[model samples]
Target: MKKIYFLIALFCTVLLHSQERYFLNSDTRLYTSPNTSSAFLGYFRYGAEVRLLSESQNGWYKVQADNFNEGYIQEKFAATRLNAKDVKIKDAENPILEGGDAYYGGNHLFVLVAGLKARALPDKNSKIKEILFTGDPVAVDYVPVNEDDWVNINGNFDEEYARYTLRKFIGLRPNFETLIKDFDNLDVNAVSERKTLSERIVELAWNSEYSKLEPAYQRYYEVVKQINDPKLIAETEMNMALAKGLAKHKLPEQIIAFTKKAEFSLKGTKTKSLYLSQTELVKTFGKPAKKANVGDECGIYLSDLFYYYPDLEVSVDEKKNQAEIVKVYINENNKFIINPNTILDNSVSEKAFIEKYGTYIEASLKSPHNYSIIMEDSQFRLVFKDGKLFSVEIFFYC
Candidate 1:
């Protein structure tokens, strides 16, 4: 037995030495791409230690965690070791506690020894998102896949493991029958935080793949289309892509064209059609300044220039076939502004949400009974009740 233990320890030490390390002596930088010249996403703080996935040729290390592995890290921070002690738990692994289950859906794990320091995410290079680090014993959850590798964990909101390294904790499965009594005070807030964390993963995945704002604004439009929150979906489409496109692309709004096309030069010029379809109007004058819609029925966009001159009133009929332009009161306050469109989509997925939302909100709103709320600029709010979805609401400002 002594020989076995010695051999295992020796092997671990050798593995650690072979792997590279990145030091968070200062603001540890997180990059968007594997190349150093890529845009920066964020950084880790001082006194943090992160392991490198591999050694790069250009004096850079491919370190994982803190969402920084997307790019190569400077070689100066590389460490020549891996020092994580093998984790083991007592008892048959019980993933779902009677009343304690942290539901953030990434790679999760439970600390085997009582009172283990659960850091934010899985690595030291990651940012701190939660206000609390400790969690109720019952709140701890895990999935043991093999004797040496646990698949998942249930840590407190801030005491989370990284999604990618969940397999590392499989050795710590505890038998439910022999486990001590679960924490009497089940923290509802912790559960909600967990759910939010899960959602954040979804957001991040979505943004990473679609929200890079590349391939033009088509991806943003697709995301909004999948969202049930009409308000958010509408608002994001209008504010982020459509509006920006109008100004940047020089697309004219359809409604405003009615006024523009009507030539007052011929006093009482009898026109065949007063109002025109936004698409048709754009063809006559220019493309839309900004436009976003849900399906083909509901959507709202604005023109580049507002008719500040009260003399012209632009109104569209229900059929969208006619427009009546007449003299009306004009208010300087009612100005036509081009706003960018935001991305809103249920399809953003769970992994994407975690990457985007992070852990700050989860730890701050640590209420056993309280839930999670995600708000964007589009007057759209997503509410989760007791760690699950509660509601999604959208409203019009005007």
Candidate 2:
């Protein structure tokens, strides 16, 4: 019975670890302990998605990032109030609002702004039917005529006499801090290989010309900005800038050149990385665990050869498939993860990287933003572009 009780406790711990939460404040700091001056565990951006851990005080809350880095944050940065008295929104200059363009689309949505009044129609003049608070999830029956107009939302029959409401205060329910997955953006080359919604959207936004992104991303960003993390705000600005740059460099080649010159990406998390000479490249990944795809179509100008391992893969360009530049890719099944500590989760976000490793490579800050890195004490190397983990390589140097 004692063992059974322990198993129940373990199950409860996992359940708490999986419960999604949000960093309601921008740049909320997570500390190693409950004290404000304790060691800084990590910094969370505005509206950054997190998980609620063990119960805590009214002033402090235990939390965890997607990376599984556990810490504590202040409570004020975590609460969402929807009451008319506590709902704080940027009041429009005009006290009254008008109807938005007619929308005919359908989907479940949420209320972004607190104290939003439910109306009979999409227009403000429509009779007020009910009141909605912040964090309230709803459904929408229509799409706005203009992409930026007020969205029409549905009411819950579960609520007393609840019906449809229309105003600019509504939002699509956020699946935590995720963005754009519903828009069909995925790195589906591998099974269930996924990126954080923010990373996915930012990636497409960075390479907008080659990306098929929806305008709805703009609307989504606006809603998420409420949490006001500086990191997210900067990315949003960069997205707009990339879109503008696309107009200047309309040609494909020119756009690529412009992007290379205009944008520089950062590593999401630093992992132990190492440099391989042409000889080392051939000797290491060349030992394939099973079969590897080798051909011109598989690599640089079809000139590079690639090797596959149970937990890792590497590609090199040379006379054979051995190229001077080598690229390594790692996924959940990569053989390098020889243990639980090396667990490679589907990731593009640095926070995820930091969470899983329990320690981030601070020295990686010195490495070139786009190159592969091997930490001084690490057995594997990670490569990131535009702040997302594109691949990881494992090798033995020790």
Candidate 3:
């Protein structure tokens, strides 16, 4: 029995030593399972350490905060080393927190930089009490103080009084999760009202939410103008122009010109529609539901083949071995989508179409009340009947 007890003690020690330690980079809640909707076990502040009990799966990890606290956490919020200090904060010129008279009557401030140093006193040379990280909320009282560059941190930093750099904290935290949720719902008003324009722009630019791209770009443009920063203005204008052009399905040459001048890439912008080959079309739409050889109207083509899919029709010129015309039929249940903002459906109106695609090169009357419009550069043709768009055709000019 003595030998068994000694072996059990040795095994427990080995298990404890084998557990890998991870430091939280962002304040994260411990969940009962690897899901956000699950009941929370506890909340761990940034800079807190946890033992990795299980490997990461589906962006979550089973971690143990202490002997009594074992739960799951998001893998992105934790790192192998306590190196939140390494994450650089952009736009350092405009520090989120300002010193002196800028202090408002707020009870808490969020840490902007990871691994922010908290000292025992207001001086930099004072002994360090603890390190705060990004997103960590520090409680404070906004009483008048003579120190212009330092602020007293209250109970949030381990119960002991500490001093942190005044400019490192922000009155309002960037709520990226709420922004993302609002963006998904296309709540333009809510998204536009979110603070932290620069940070929000970065997140929205990286997202593939095409339906709200134009609105978001417009909002960014409005907000950026207020900033009066030349670099930011140029960037926002370029991005907004790209978003507008993409929504309108501008010519490939025009798109290339816009992209060349822009500093960043739009998430899902593609210029391949102007010169779609048979292989590319096949790859995009899979096998067509029907195919047939049709008489060629243009003398340049030897034969024309019509390929029909759910709500799309492709006219392939056999001699050139390229798709000459692509027609999209819009209906209530159509799955055809040109972009996030441009969906081929009955919901699109003639005015809306013109607004989305930009100015047309020429407009001709097909009949007494029907009209056929050719877009700029003659790459697209739109047919309208009774002031409503019927079909949109992509014309691949040789």
Best by lDDT: 3
How do the predictions measure up, each by TM-score?
0.20, 0.22, 0.26
Candidate 1 vs candidate 3: which has greater TM-score?
3
| Whole-model lDDT, model 2 | 0.44
RMSD of model 1 against the true structure: 21.4
What's the best-to-worst order under TM-score?
Answer: 3, 2, 1
Write candidate 3's Cα lDDT for 244-328 as tens digits: 5445554555543432321111122232343446776677667889999866555433236788887677776545657643666
User: So what's the TM-score on candidate 3?
Assistant: 0.26
Per-residue CA lDDT of model 1 for 1-398, tens digit only, reads: 99999888867764674453444333335455556578653333332355555535576665544322344556654444323431222222233333323432322333333223333455545554432222213122332223333221333222344331233322323432222112113243355433333323322222232222222233333444544468756444433332232223212243232123222111222223333443443344343243322222223222222222222333333255443322222122221111112222324333233334322122111332121222221222343343332333222233
Which RMSD values do the candidates have, in order?
Answer: 21.4, 23.5, 20.7
**In candidate 1, residue 173 scores what lDDT?**
32
Error of 3 at 178 (Å): 65
Kindly provide the TM-score of model 2 when superposed on the true structure, using C-alpha atoms.
0.22
Model 3 poorest 10 in a row by lDDT: 260-269
Q: Which stretches of candidate 1 lie over 4 Å from their true place?
A: 1-22, 33-36, 66-69, 80-398
